[model samples]
Target: MEPIDDLVGRLGRWSAGRGPLFLLLATRLRQLIDDGVLPPGALLPPDRRLAGALAVGRTTVVAAYDTLRQEGRVVRRQGSGTRVAPAVPTPGPRVAETSNPLFLHLLDAPDDVILLSCAAPLGPPPELTRAYATMTLPADDLGYHPAGLGALRTAIAGRYRSQGVATVPEQILVTTGAQQALSLLTRLLVAPGDGVLLEAPTYPGALDLFREASAGLLPVAVGPDGLDVDAALRLMERHRPVLAYVVSCYQNPTGAVLPPLKGRRLVERAAALGVPLVDDEVLADLTLPGGDGPAPSPLAAYEGGSGEGGVIGVGSLSKVVWGGLRVGWIRGPQPLIARLARLKAVHDLGSDVPAQLAAVRLLAGFAPVQAARTRALRTGHDHLRAELGRLLPSWTCPPAAGGQTLWVRLPYGDGVSFAQVALRHGVAVLPGRTMDALGGSGPYLRLHFLLGPEALTEAVRRLARAWEEYEPQPAAPHAVAPGAVPAIVV
Candidate 1:
């Protein structure tokens, strides 16, 4: 988008509420061109001239034009102004292999589109952003740092301490992202064919990683109460998996929090069986409440100094500040962290020094990022829960005490197909199978309320529309209307 004179004035005159003017122009204009308002071979106004007409930044005009060209909404010949395209190619899912397009597709979607796909914080707090921008020098300000700085290690450990888990900085190895941390741990701890116990609807990509390691994946049941503790224990004892990865707080698919009681029980049981607990507290910012009551600290806390080992807690700043800020770390026994650090060096030398600096700034400036996350996600969450309760009474959402999304079990629908339908309806939804280690969601969908009215509601409504289409029976006769019960065929 280029600078244009009176850009603000034009937008004020023509634009409506809460949308990027440039984006709106691009969208509406593309629709116009498609409808033949601007016939093929018709010239578009020059960027600067158009900016004057719309009273928007010339950059906005340039962007609108660029998008038009990119999407084949228009064509430009050398020495000629842009011309309407004969046809426009509708945008479709871009499945990129080299880089994860799942993340990128998110960026491409409309800002108002609900983002249930990624477990991301709604947005960083102002204090956090300020702190990140004001990070100090000398710790290699612009240098590359693979292992997070000693300061961050101390701060992260301090964070866990308040939650009653005392850990040493040396016991924490910071990586680029929590996903990266998990990847490194898998490489270091899991050997091909090693048994790995995971929650059935566990983190989806993790299954892929464990598979790549050739680990024999085992699924343990997790119900509305969270992880089926006894079931998990049995699986752990039976398989003696090389890694027993579980999300302790605000679990991904279920938004299940492992309360303190269950956390202790799980740790003790795992220790008794000699199974490592790779606890991912990635979304454990105490940001969302759980249906089962208060959230628990890391399961590793239950380990204490029992010297049993095998309890490692993984987390990162991506959820708190920005996903672009690729800084994740693991806290466990010092020896294990050191080993993980060694493992981290293999893929990439280190995290960006600037990012580490920003993280440090974030930690110091804000009392705790968790505090800010809680405040930010609350309103959106309440609205989402309320709307769902009213519109989809059959859907089960077990009141997440804290997390970014609600794990919803559709009473009579398959999550996978619903998600596919959501895409066609212009909403983004992640089904249970994709998130599960086992390929079944049992009619579940993860609804992210963090995006708020900006996107969440529309997406949910779109999902509701999809649901409406899925109902098998047509409208019943007057006897079967709202107040009356129909005859039961069975």
Candidate 2:
């Protein structure tokens, strides 16, 4: 049995984040269990004893324990009391082994290493700073806004409406980021053993989340144009997935934009099949110079205003404005939005109020911000491509129309092993396997062009060195055809 004093000590600063007290307690307890600090089958302190030690009400402790029990993390009986659940084999990668290298760097990284693993702006734009400067908060209202501030929600809805999606404020539910929006939707729609349709080389974060839910992943190939709608529909009809997630515009890793005709066909088919489609448009606004005119209307635009069939659109400012700003939203039917808001409230009560206020201002004057971002991105993208072509001419690096990454196919070896070599050579890159659901992208690597020209050049030099050191391995049998993965022209 874990000692009450030691357990309390392990849960240091647990109450720092917002949300219900029980949720905070449960979150801390979950961490301890996952870390094996509280070993499997270890008995926990009685609710009253823990409550007394943590200086909280017994009910809070009880609710926390109940939450854990619901997650199957603990087993409780009247006579035997609560004990940590015995370890069991689970689907997908362990929580400790995050697929995104950015997370690993966040925890710890060497100072000299050039990070090409995560594709994000180097710094917040001037517009973000200006937005923060002029932002004001409400004095009379309590800060909590589970569904987000009304003004911000209105702004988000208006943005969607302007893009041809007939959205109202009632359809918007603001979340911490697109990541949380996905998490909340997964909780609501996906159950253990349920099937989820995903693009083959999708966002690593989404793959991680679905895997954590123990959802069976169905991988559909995505090319330069976008998701293989025919393959996706065939799988939907055969497997009847509970949910389908797609990055409709400027997809992560691949940087593929779904053609408008295909987008319409996909939503229409998904509606007919009764599968809730989640359109992740976090990268939609990241259009580079000399690329496609503008990202096509969001997937929701294809689904009529009836809102009966699910075509949930998720958007975020993390990619366009800044990652630290942490403002994102979900556009769905009114009922779905309302339910998601309740789920979000249980997680964080609400997103940062000041951030929401600033987001409103940012959206109001977004033209210049977007223009500036695309210009910088275009420069970075061109510079990175040139360096790669000159330094490692053998590798097949396709040009992306938009988005931060370039999906490069290795000349011979797999990405997983080469990634380790790249890290040792002072550059970090994401292995294609981590982003792939079926491990068919072994011959590929997703490299970001977010760094400055000098840094990108240095990173490419490091990668070239790593390539020389890395021994060539025979291509994996499951590797997809290089011809199928083309660059996004528009």
Candidate 3:
């Protein structure tokens, strides 16, 4: 299984829309083995690891392995892991090779393949390296700060104060990243089966965490103007969700910044309904310079009268600094922060001390890093928009006001199928379905403009080739018979 684990993620694109997920995965594995792409006796990755990579439920991987065993295509030993059966019979008829984008991205591409999935900046700002050189941790002290280092906490609190929201060091709890902050909040605020509201196409990572908590979802649609204040109010009143999560600043997938008025109203309405709101600000400072002027104050700042609002804020250095820094903080009422810190301690004890020191240094000297990142993002945004217009004229790609991606709509064909074709052209793009909470992300795909101008040009060129070569999926048998009429199922 040395290299097989690396190959398991490639199965995702091919597994899309093809019967039962387990069967599709199993059949694809069989095809690879029969074609000698996976030679006889090749070891398979552990089911759990493969499941994590695919972003599928582990049970899917378990069932797939079971199906392969039943077909006599793979063998599972008591002590060792699964392996392809030796001298496998040839597959019947020549099944067409999978056109999955991930398959090609993983197995076919060379070192220079373009990336459109990740929105992370390439590296930390130069100031970070210098900051690390001058910063130091206490040599004699044991390094455990569950609520984060005092200096870092003070620095982060100062950021909130600068934004008009008065915060103290005690109100901030640092976690490994914004993801961990979400996890901690989910566990603290949501009970199993509790109703949770979110935007229709919010951050997929947040959706995954809520799903993992078994929270019932109430999705409100978001348009180009960001979360609809009216729709959010309606959903809040109707569903009575226990908690609602929103990305008010430079929202993900859509790259739509919430209008200040709408953001204020949404927070007020949620507070009126007694539902707590979590505002993810990981992409807050990434506002494209000169476009929106400046990012509006966080939703929590809208709390008027009596000082207590339902809003809780989460911030991270990952998007503004480098993702590798692994520094993020949760800002909420002191009581919530205390409870969350207890839960966070149980989860991982504490985040890295050195990274926290680095973050503190970066925050102290953030002006230059912010300028550099803004320049990079603005360049990427312009290049991507220009290329899409030149190469994909029929496709509608809205210009991003801020944030790292352009949410594009295809004039024809499904994003899933188009993604498979794109993979073959040496470009990898995420289909829209991955971002949908209610599985309504049809006809859309998200493309990150984080790459440089040259790579963006080449990537779009590859995408155009893929678009030309893409064939519409053949109609499935379930659609209709020759003269049969459709009937509604009750």
Candidate 1, residue 318: lDDT: 75
The digit string of per-residue lDDT tens for model 1 on 1-490 reads 2123312221222333235666667755653343232445657778888887776789988887888898877887777778776532335522123233344555465654555676666555676567656656684354544567778888887777777776777777888888788888888888745678888677765665765554656666677667888878866765577778888777766876666788889888887888878898877765553444456667877777632367888888776676777888888777787777776777777777767777877776554566666666777788888877777777887676776778887776566556656666666666664554433463677777667564666766776776777666332111101111111000
Q: Name the 10 consecutive residues with the lowest summed lDDT in model 2.
A: 481-490
In terms of lDDT, model 2 sits at 0.81
As for candidate 2, its clashing pairs are none
- Return whichever of 1 and 3 wins on TM-score: 3
Winner on TM-score between 2 and 3 is: 2
lDDT against true structure, model 3? 0.75
lDDT, candidate 3, at 413: 63
Model 3 regions lying over 4 Å from their true place: 1-112, 305-308, 471-490
Residue 349 displacement (Å), model 3: 1.4
Over 326-441, each residue of candidate 2 has an lDDT whose tens digit, in order, gives 88999998999999998989889999999999899888889888988889989999999999999999999988888888999998767876887888999888878667654457
Residue pairs with backbone overlap in model 3: none
C-alpha lDDT score of every prediction, in listed order:
0.66, 0.81, 0.75
Model 1 residue runs over 4 Å out of place are 1-104, 107-113, 139-144, 287-294, 306-308, 473-490
All predictions: root-mean-square deviation over Cα? 20.5, 15.1, 13.7
Which regions of candidate 2 deviate over 4 angstroms?
1-102, 306-308, 471-490
